[model samples]
Target: MQAPEFLAAHAAEAERAIAQVLDDRASVVPERLLEAMRYSLMAGGKRVRPALVRECYRACGGVDDARVLPAMMAIEAIHTYSLIHDDLPCMDDDDVRRGSPTCHRRFDEATAVLAADALQALAFELLASADIEAELRCELIRRLALAAGCQGMVGGQMMDMQAEDGSGIDLMQVERIHLHKTGALLCWCCEAGALLAGAGSDQLDACSRYGKAVGLLFQIADDILDATASSETLGKSAGKDAAQHKATYVSVLGLVPARELAAEMLELAIAAGSTLGEGGQPLNTLAQYIMGRDR
Candidate 1:
């Protein structure tokens, strides 16, 4: 299938799965918080992470078992939660996401925070409650916790925050921040997908390498978008990173250099996909799609 059609199909599947898991109409104990969670979760994006999981499983010759769906949902939930918190007044302080009002903007600050926390907890809960093998479930939980916690995304966020005050950050520092904050979860998505598909160490390593290259490329593309895209096209505040004085590739390296770097990373990602042989072509196509995405 073409990239657009493939993405559309996977995005639909992801939305269905998320709705099924989050459809607790039982009085809404958390009421506003639940609304906030739904608000952000349902707000449309590429659904790339969940699609990565599904694609990776397919690449590994795995069947579409029910057990894989929970992991996919949990990853997306975690990603949405991160976006919610990242848009808080204390974080990116944005008013928009996916062309809609941010969670904090739509709901109150407290509700947004509560929703993010709830989503984070729900991610772990889903992993624990899934009908997968006990050992596999445990490993998934551990990997996700590590990726989402201090050692990964949280740590990267801290680095970003610290660098926001005109702090001098080199290319390496910028890469590290993105690798931890963004790349880690992406890597987890690929690794977890392979694991769910019963892949061996070699396959897992290939996925990890693919994730690393694509993750960095994705961030580089974001920098380019911020530099060139309009808010209408981006579906969020463009130039917010520059406005915040965040250390980005375009900030440190010139826009031309940043674009070059992104191209290099994309090449690396495609090369990594080659290690998966024929089954990896979809991944290569995904890398190209991400690099060329208008939104």
Candidate 2:
């Protein structure tokens, strides 16, 4: 399949799996909280994280997607939870996300906050309860916690908030912030796939390298889009970074240079995946899609 078709296929499977997971929990979850969770969880985006998990597994010679379904579900839950919190008044304070009103705006701040918390817990729950072997499950949970917790995505977010003042910031600082904030979880996705597939060391190394490069590339692409794309195209407020004086690749390096950096990262990502031979085709395609995505 082509890139759009591949992404859409993976995204559809992810949503189906997500809905089943939510349905299984509907019996105990409060109606309002569940609704809030569903509003954002089901809200359509590229589902890139889940796709990464699935594709990386395939790249590692994993045949059955079902084997990694829980991992896919777990990663997306954490990703969506982050988005909900990120859109709160205390964070980006945006009213729109995925072309819909944000969780806090659609429901209420308390509901949004509670829903995000519940989803965070749910991510671990899914992994802990998966049918995978005990050792693998534990490893997945541990890695995910490290990725989503203070040492990873959360830390990067804190750095981003601190950098909003735009004082004494440089390109290295910007890269560091994004590596933790965006790159950590992405790296986890790749690692989770390889681990699930029981990939050899070489395949594992390639995925890790690809994930790191793509992580930075993804953020740089977002910076470019935020600078150039309209809110209609972006499905969120445009120029918020500039308005907020946030440090980004575009802010540190000029737009032209930022694009150059993204190109360099793209090559790195593709070359890393090349080590997998035919199994790496999907990964290369996905990296190209990330670089060229309009939103």
lDDT of 1 by residue, 122-171 (tens): 89998999888999999999999999999999999998889999658899
Residues 1-295, candidate 2: write the lDDT tens digits: 2355777888888789889888888889888999998899999988888889998999999998898989988998999999999999999899999789999999999999999999999899999999989999999999999999999999999999988875579999999999999999999999999999999999999999999999999999999999999999888999988999889899889899999999999999999989989989989999999999999
lDDT of each: 0.88, 0.92
Off by over 4 Å in 2: 1-3
Best by lDDT: 2
How far out, in Å, is residue 39 in model 2? Answer: 0.4
Instruction: Give the TM-score (vs. native) of candidate 2.
Output: 0.98
lDDT of 2: 0.92
Model 2, position 5, has a per-residue lDDT of 74
TM-score of each: 0.96, 0.98
